[model samples]
Target: MVKYFHNGLDHYFREGDLNKVLSLCLHRFEEHGDLGTEFFIYIENAILKNKEYVLQNLKNMPSDFALRGVVEYGLGCIAASEFRLESTIEHLRNAFSLSMKVLDVFENEHGFCKSVVPFIAKEAYNLKPYDNLKDEEILLPKIKFSKIEKETDFFVLASCNGIYFDRYFEEFYETIRQHNENNIYHIHIANPTSQTEKLIAELDDPNFKFSFENTNRGASYFACMRLFIARRLMENYNCGCLVSDIDVRWIKSPSKIWAGLNKADFGWYPKPGPAPSLLVHAQIIAFSKTQKAFEILEKSNQFLAYKLSEFPSWCLDQSSLFRAVCLTPEAKTQDFRETLGDIETVQRLPDTSLTEKQAFRAFENIEISMNSDGYPILSRVD
Candidate 1:
């Protein structure tokens, strides 16, 4: 039976059959031995189904095994799912330390053991919640916008406080209009103040329509609000949507680039890193009006809500976006930089002298550029 299971497992793994691999791994564990492989399989299944069960299994793991670090990591994931922030951090920190120790022991060991440390470390780091802001109340207004009179190819959704709107909206609107004059832009602002309203009314281009809602002042509110708007645009208008941070600038016409992304359900510029480690920047994302994209957005909305309720952080949106991308098999993403050029953040280009033309020139010349974030300094780039 062991020989039979081994042969079957080898075949399933070779054929890239996930369900079969999981099933066989679980069955193999039922017969004893292969505890490490069993733990991984159990945790993977628990992530999708019963996290409490995974926690119980992890607690039962023997103390001396090298993969006990993985058990701690599983505990961290379970804690995160339960919204136990302190427990989550403690478990993940232990996971990181234990994984490092295991890596040291396997310094000369190649293949699978060598691969484990990086995976453990990265997952542990990613699972750690961003700095807690200690605020969790729904601040967004309940009012909804009626259908607009003009037809639009797409919509851009963003949220900001009064300070950001005052500082950035003019340049953001101007740059977008300069590049995408032909397309109608439905710009929705969440938590708009009187100053923002005045600015929107003054900018009153027929091609640009503004909608506003008042929301609580926090990163979670803004992130969830963006998700809300994205769903509404996709459902009501049945059109493609581009959700961007207020600080993001369109150096070139985004319409053409968006049109070119026919192969993907959604597209975003990835943060620069190794391919497997790369995460999509939530600041600027274009989603096609497909069921797959809609489902991803919907799931992301729920995920952001849960994460915010537990530990509010600026990264909740992007982290939720990353998880949504990972979980949704049908949701395909493309590198938006390939079409529209790389994003530039103020952190990367601190010198104020770099004109918009110079920035575009750099992107066109294949120079490195930073992706957009909530940084106020990025909006100051003229």
Candidate 2:
């Protein structure tokens, strides 16, 4: 009976417009920053569009099963967006509880959507702790670094594979040198080989720090883990930290980003997409050295630690970052776009397979500099 009803619910979503409309709502919520009450109503209406039909078909099978559960979950998300904590908790409980039951029976089944259970469960658990945090405790005035006579004010940390070291490292280092303005750099390599370690050791730059991490669990796990590691690295220092991806090219100095920390504990570029997970890119994130920043990182780690020991690939760290932001009351965050020009950078070259020499030759005649308009420019030099 459970199997039959589950299959029926699947067919309903696949054949109906409700799923499509709901997806559209999720995507557009972050895309347009249109989290108005009307937007919430639109989402609620879409979820309920075929709810009656779905509930009728699944009647007597299991209460609050399948599409009914989805409706609850959708409502919970809307409640969360609207800051209706009580309603959000109640709806999510119903939705995630039902989801767990469904997964217990069908998780091993072929082609089952196994990720949903873990994802929903994580959200449910994380929100509980979030609910317990007091508004006063979560929101606090931003802390500033004292004026110390240090060579560098802050450091940029990045993670990457050793294979791309030669492909992008030089250009990456050069760009940072251009805009570093006395800031340091830290590179975390994922399981570097002996040769990779040796090569990195040859660099005589005192301003750069390097570390290797065990990324066997994959990128998502490493992403979340890096936050904890970063927090530890900043413990003794009175400075801000910027976490970046190695493939990124620094077009503008992060000084503007660092200055943003004066008003907030966290700073980042929010990519247009769904909230909580796909809402922001983890590419470049600035964290000020403060109790608030540490608390947020600690909370983020706690959420991942309670992931039932299963790392679901549904933007694990990104979702946790969002939850951390939400959990912190009045979490002061500055969007880099507010002060800096487009934070976008060319992530990778068109042909990634190019050899290091080939890559160097390719960029030899191209100059990476700012145009008169103050925008980063890449132009061929004759």
Candidate 3:
């Protein structure tokens, strides 16, 4: 069986015999007890099914549902992106509720969950609540992008240079193609470097790419972030821009923002959350070349690059950009709201769906103390 499978790798892929290839892997799983090979086949199958095999494996996990939660979150992410799911609050609530089980109850799995946040974010983009302007809003004739006598084409910027960047390229490219199809976006990549560039190069190869500019500035998050933002602005070719870090992908149609660009006042608002009152700069801003957009981008980039000494090293590019936005009235006062940091906050674990055993186990790792009556309490400690 192993020999047959070995010889048939090309045959299965060439002949589109996915099931046959899967069967061979399952056979190998039984024969060799190799969980790695099992997961390899399982992930592929899950993608085909749109539920990610992570769920199936966890359904029968040897007694680690928390770990299963970890896997489920990853799978949930894959399931979210590959499938065009329903965009209802109930579903988002479901994911958020489930993730709590995984994140809160699995103390033993803390390191594991943290390790996969990037990959998880890629997948999570697929599974969350997607809201768009109402039909009345969308029905309003989209402002034709050509009206402004602008020489600029819309540049949808994404920076995907890290480890999970390659695994999520298929997902990312799907989004790029969708935007491109709308004739509203010309996707460009700012992926400075990663291990899987060769595979990424083979896969559609971005319309534009860049080499990372080393500042010899060590691993300080402050310096690197300044560099990223500076590079994003310095490298932009478009006269207009819709930019975001690679982390928070578009869960729904980005067309609104495309049109929003045409009408945006380019102001800022305090987008505070229930979590904390954090200050944020304009993430998604749009204005024509004649407008202050380019000036702001150039000025912000240069300013952040030099003022790296102002913000803490941990705040990174977003922080630097926030600082720039604060100083510039054109940027700081914009009413434009781009859903930037939304992806990272996705709730994908299935806490409520957990069996009682699963729920109780989660309670153990949930660091916060439970009352004598057994109600869990939230602690300041993470």
The number of clashing residue pairs in model 1 is: 3
- Range of the 10 consecutive residues with the lowest summed lDDT in candidate 3: 135-144
* Cα misplacement distance, residue 346 of candidate 3 (Å): 13
Q: What tens digits encode model 2's per-residue C-alpha lDDT throughout 236-347?
A: 3456688876666666676756775565888776654322343346767878887887877887776666541432333556666766776686667777778674665423
Best by TM-score: 2
lDDT of 1 at 279: 52
lDDT of 1 by residue, 54-95 (tens): 445456656665666777867766665544546755676676
Q: Which portions of model 1 show Cα errors greater than 4 Å?
A: 1-143, 149-151, 273-278, 344-382
Pull out the clashing pairs in model 2. none
What lDDT does the true structure give each of the candidates? 0.57, 0.54, 0.37
Ordered by TM-score, highest first, the candidates read 2, 1, 3
TM-score of each: 0.55, 0.58, 0.39
Clashes of each: 3, 0, 16
lDDT over C-alpha atoms for residue 164 of model 2: 52
lDDT ranking of the models: 1, 2, 3
Error of 1 at 65 (Å): 15
